[model samples]
Target: MSITLYALDGCPFCVKVHDALEANEIEYETVWTEAMHSDRNEVKRVSGQRGVPVLVDEDRGVTMAESEKILEYIDQTLAQ
Candidate 1:
């Protein structure tokens, strides 16, 4: 199972999720949100939304938005 995060550099929620991932020892790669329409298309393709800090959990077959939900999912799945 692998985890990927879609986020923006200046987003507070993105930073929160990143911090949680690090603290919980979750190995995840971040894909930045759009600098252009094309960059954003990937996020839309994956999650169907423009929200940053989306978490895609390949192991559980979940793609989610919102920082809190992402954090909660991470805590439940990997924080142990």
Candidate 2:
């Protein structure tokens, strides 16, 4: 399973997702996004928006934004 998290440094939402992933022992790759929304091309390419804490789960064909929803999805699909 390949999971990629699009995050920005110092973003609390991103920290939440990062913490959850770590607590669950779920291995994932972190794609650090730019601070400026206009510079977040990679995030927009996958998620249609330039929001931090975007999650791309290739194994599930899921690409989503927002921290709460991402956490919920992780719990439902990837939590042990």
Candidate 3:
């Protein structure tokens, strides 16, 4: 399973999602949104919104936004 996260530094929601992933011991690759101005294009293309803390779980075919919902979904999926 490949999990990728689009996030920016100093974003509280991003930090929340990251902490949840860490607590679950889930490994993921981060695409830093603050890296450059042009880098946000990828996030916009993937999610249709210019937001941080977007996550793509390739194996599950899930692309998610929002920290609370993403955390709940991950916990439920992991439980199952």
Which candidate has the top score in lDDT? 2
After superposing candidate 3, which stretches have Cα over 4 Å from the reference?
A: 35-39
Order of candidates by lDDT, top first? 2, 1, 3
| Residue 12 miss distance in model 3 (angstroms) | 0.6
Q: Please give the lDDT score at residue 80 for candidate 1.
A: 51
Model 3 agreement with the true structure over 29-80: per-residue lDDT tens digits: 9988965556689898888877778989999889988888888877987423
TM-score of each: 0.89, 0.98, 0.87
- TM-score of model number 2: 0.98
Ranking by TM-score: 2, 1, 3
Q: Candidate 3: minimum summed lDDT over ten consecutive residues — where?
A: 71-80
lDDT of 2 by residue, 1-80 (tens): 79999999999999999999999999999999899999999888898888888999998899999999999999999999
lDDT of each: 0.87, 0.94, 0.84
Candidate 3's error at 52, in angstroms?
1.3
Tens digit of lDDT per residue, candidate 1, span 1-80?
Answer: 59999998888999999999999887889898875555687889899987787899888899999999988988887785
Scored by TM-score, the top model is 2
For model 2, the run of ten residues with the poorest summed lDDT: 43-52
